[model samples]
Target: MRIGLYPGTFDPVTHGHLDIIRRSCALVDRLVIGVAINRSKGPMFSLEERVAMLEPICAQMSQDTGCQVIVHPFENLLIQCAADVGASIIVRGLRAVADFEYEYQMVGMNRALDDSIETVFLMAEARHQAIASKLVKEIARLGGDVSKFVTPEIEAKLKDKLASS
Candidate 1:
C-alpha cells in the first residue's frame, strides 16, 4: 500500500491543514499525519492534545475518502519518522513563496538523508492559503474570531484553551 507522511506541529489543526489532508488522500492509500513534538517552538497545545484533536477529524476523513488516516506523534527527525510510518512519500502543504524557500531546503536535506523517499508539495486553496496555525493562535489569544481559520469544534477548543491559559 502507498503510505504518505504529512508532518506538522498541528498545535491546533487549521482549515488549511484539513485542506491538505483531504487532498492528500487521493495520492496514498494510507495518510499518516505526523504530529511533531518540537519543544523549540513552544506550541500552544500539548502533543497529546494535538493528537486528540486530530484523531476524530482524521477518522472522519478516512471514512469519507476510503483512505486510512492515522495520527502519529513523533519527536525524532522527520525523515526517520517517515521511515517509521512506512511512508515513501512525504506530503507538504505550501502556502506561499516564503514557505517554498524553507521547504526546498528541507526537501534537499531529506533527499540527501534518504533518496528513496520523495517529497510532494500541495498548494493550499486560495482561501486557506492565508490561514496558518500560528496566525490562528495569535488571533485567538487576542480575542479575535478564528471561525474562519478553524472548525467550530477547534474554535471552541481554542477558546477554552485560551481561557484556561
Candidate 2:
C-alpha cells in the first residue's frame, strides 16, 4: 500500500489543514497525519489534545474518501517519523512563496538524509491559503470569531480552551 506522511504541529487543526488532508487522500492509500511534539514552539494545545482533535476528523475523512487515515504523534525527526510509518511520500501543504522558501530547504535536507522518501507539496485552496493555526489562535485569544478558519467543533474547543486559559 502507498502510505504518505503529513507532519505538522497541528496545535489546532485549521480548515487549511483539512483541505490538504482531503486532497492528500487521492495520492496514497493510507494517509498518516503526523502530529509533531515540538516543545520549542510552545503550542497552545497539548500533544494529546491535538491528537484527540484530529482522530475524529480523520476517521470521518477516511469514511468519506475511502482512504485510511490515521493520526500518529511524533517527537523525533520528521524523516524518521515517515520511516516509522512506512511512508515513502511526505506530504506538505504550501500556502505562499514564504512557505516554499522554508520547505525548499527542508526538502533538500530531508533528501540528503534519505533520498528514497520524496516530498510532495499541495497548494492550499485560495480561500484557505490565508488560514493558519497560529492566526486562528491569535484571533480566538483576542475574542475574535474563528468560525471561518476552523470547524464549528474546533471553534468550540478553541473557545473553551481560551476561556480556561
Candidate 3:
C-alpha cells in the first residue's frame, strides 16, 4: 500500500520525466503522476492535451516496468492530492544544485503542511540534467528538432500544436 505522488506541470512529458518515473517505479507499489495545473507558467498544451499525452506514456510505463502509473490533474495545493490518495511520499527529480535549491524549499513546505508526508528526491540521469520542458518548447518554437527529448507521440502533438498556434 506504499503509494507515492509525482506532481508537476508536465507541459510535455519528456524522457527526463520518464526516467524519473521509471526509477521510482521500483520502490513504490503505485505512483500517481500528478499533472498539476500551474497558473504561473504559460503552457504550450492544454490540460486535456497534457492528460492525453500522459495517458499513453503512463500505460506504456506500467507495461514496461510492471509498476502501476496513473495520471491525475490537480488544481488544489499538492498536499491535498497526496492526502486524497493516502500517499505519504512526494517523488521529485533533482537535476542540479539549482534544482535542489528550489525543490528543497518546496519539499520543506510540503512537509510542514503535512508532517506525515515525506518528499523523496531522485537525481535525474546525467544526460538529462539539462533537458526540461521549457528547453524543449523553446527548441520546437524556434524550429529546432527536439526528437530526442520527448517521445514520438509527444513530438507529433507538439508539432500539431505549433503548426496551429
Candidate 4:
C-alpha cells in the first residue's frame, strides 16, 4: 500500500493543514499525520492534546474521503518517523515561494538520508494560502477572529485556549 507521511508540529491544525491532508489523502492509500513534538517553539497545546484534537477530525476526513487517516506523534527525525510507519512519500504543503525554498532544502536532505522515500509538495488553496498555524495563534492571542482560517471546532479550541491563557 502507498502510505504517505504528513508530518508537522500541528501546534493547532489550521484549515491550510486540513486542505493539504485532504489533497494528500487522494494520492495515497493511507495518510499518517505525524504531530511532531516541538518544544523549542513552545506550542500552545500538548502533544496528547494535539492528538486528541486531531483524532475526530482525521476520522471525519477518513470517512469523507474513504481513506484511512492516522494521527500519530513522533519525537524523532521526520525521515525516521516515515520509515517507522512505512511511508514511501512525504506530503508537504507549500503556501508560497518562500515555503518552496525552505521545503526544497529539507527535501534534498531527506532524499540524501533516504532515497527510497520521496517528498510531494502540494500547493495550498488560495483561500488557505495565508492561513498558517503560527499566524492563526498570534491572531487569536490578539483577540482576532479566526473563524475564516480554521474549522469551527479548531476555532473554538483556539478561543478556549486563548481565554484561559
| Colliding pairs, model 2 | none
Model 4 Cα lDDT, one tens digit per residue, 84-158? 999999999999999999999999999999999999999999989998899999999998998998889988888
Q: Which lDDT tens digits does candidate 2 get at residues 90-142?
A: 99999999999999999999999999999999999999999989999999999
Worst 10 residues of 4 by lDDT: 156-165
Residue 154 error, candidate 3, Å: 0.8
lDDT for 54 in candidate 3 is: 96
Instruction: Please give, for residues 58-159, the per-residue lDDT of candidate 3 as tens digits.
Output: 998999988899999999989999998878889999988999999988988888888899899999999888889999999999999999899888998889
Estimated TM-score per prediction? 0.99, 0.99, 0.97, 0.98
Deviation from native of the Cα of residue 138 in model 2, angstroms: 0.5
Show model 2 residue runs off by greater than 4 Å: none
User: Which 10 consecutive residues of model 1 have the lowest summed lDDT?
Assistant: 156-165
